[model samples]
Target: MEGHIVLKNVQKSFGPKQVLRGLSVSVKKGRSLVVIGGSGTGKSVMLKCILGIIRPDAGEIRVGGESCIGLKGKDRDAFLARFGMLFQGAALFDSLTVWENVAFGLIQGRGMARHAARDIAVEKLSQVGLSSDVAALYPAELSGGMQKRVGLARAIAADPEIIFFDEPTTGLDPIMADVINNLIVDCVKRLGATTISITHDMASARKIADDIAMIHKGQIIWQGEANKVNVSGNAYVDQFIHGRADGPIQMDVLKA
Candidate 1:
């Protein structure tokens, strides 16, 4: 059985501005792949394309040996049911309590009983080291780190076959960031899910990725094992990982 997710010659554009240009990558079953790139480099666009939130102008995307581009109606719902996402800002509902937020997919999307969904929500919260008490509070009541953990719990509530993490460690203190990273590794290992994450945070990437691919100006310029990123010998990768300003990668900043 082939369970690998593959993308080939993918392209997307918004009118005149092309976002993805023949971007290709693959992740094996039960492996973690992280995409690193600067802002507006189409990392999110590539992810959205895979999620079917955005349709690609061209190319192929295969998940578990089936095409996943431009799915509709029941097909789209079924395809989306196989994946989970943790957004960059937690993206929780301010009105809903934590448990309600976590169980939203189950009760709403799957039509599961609220009681059953709540139980699963509590269980997932435990997986991320959050207590049942925390599940009673709204998103606004929690600290930034706690809110992120809630997002993670909600992500795994459905026990998805594939999970996508978008900038998981952004905006947290270093210690909290490490905490989230450890939780992500533990949870993913326990579930044995194939994962795709988009971020420029090398620390989080190093902690979570089996493979790392760098995107630049709508293309994957370099890719390799996470352990070998330091010695990739590509100047762009070198400049990025080291956080250097004086490198081949130029920012589109206006003169101040």
Candidate 2:
């Protein structure tokens, strides 16, 4: 109950290939935890299991101290309502305006009136440093940074107790990425929401994480405070944080 989210011996497999092998981690209430891993290491799958988009083969996922595994119908919806997500690549609807995208959960999920939802959407957008006029524009018209801001607005619009950020700073210039990182830290602090973010960006991880955990081959290999990452005493952590190719971790690339 004290932790916002907890995963215990969770496992998931796709046919013969296992993605999450008894993975376990916990996010303390109102704290920020960042999961760092390389590509195809089941980072996304772990998040999907927590979101109920993918069912785990075994083990338990608890949100606010209640079991969420195998929840169905209204039970699942209620469980989902307590969380917000900012997906990788700002997965906004191209057909909708900025405000409409931000207000989607309020109007569709919560069944709020359209006008009222739009007003709240604008307010959330403002909190993310967007002007009111930008709300009338479609996602396609905005730059990458602006689109990310819109996605952040939508993620926080519901004011949920927990937020999940998947690759929050991916595909942006260094400056823009840092800006988004700052916004994420500020917004989560203001809302007092427990956050779990997955990223390979060390800079972003340093900016937003209180604790950092590294996943490799479907299991957490190391976990410690963000400040202690430089001296983590784990070769895998050193290889990852320094982006070195000559370390203990071997990539699965075919020999030329």
Q: Count backbone clashes in candidate 2.
A: 0
- lDDT by residue for model 2 (76-158), tens: 88888888899899999999999999999999998999999999999999999999999999999999999999999999999
Which parts of model 1 are misplaced by more than 4 Å? 1-3
TM accuracy, model 2: 0.98
Location of the lowest summed lDDT over 10 successive residues in candidate 2: 1-10
Write model 1 residue lDDT over 1-256, tens digit each, in one string: 5438999999999999999999988889999999999999999899899999899999999999999997999999999999989999999999999999999999999999999999999999998988999988999999999999999998999999999999999999999999999999998998899999998889999999999999999999998889999999999999999999889999977987
Query: Relative to the true structure, how large is the alpha-carbon lDDT of every model?
Result: 0.93, 0.94
**Root-mean-square deviation of every model:** 1.3, 1.0
- Looking at candidate 2, what is the lDDT of residue 21? 95
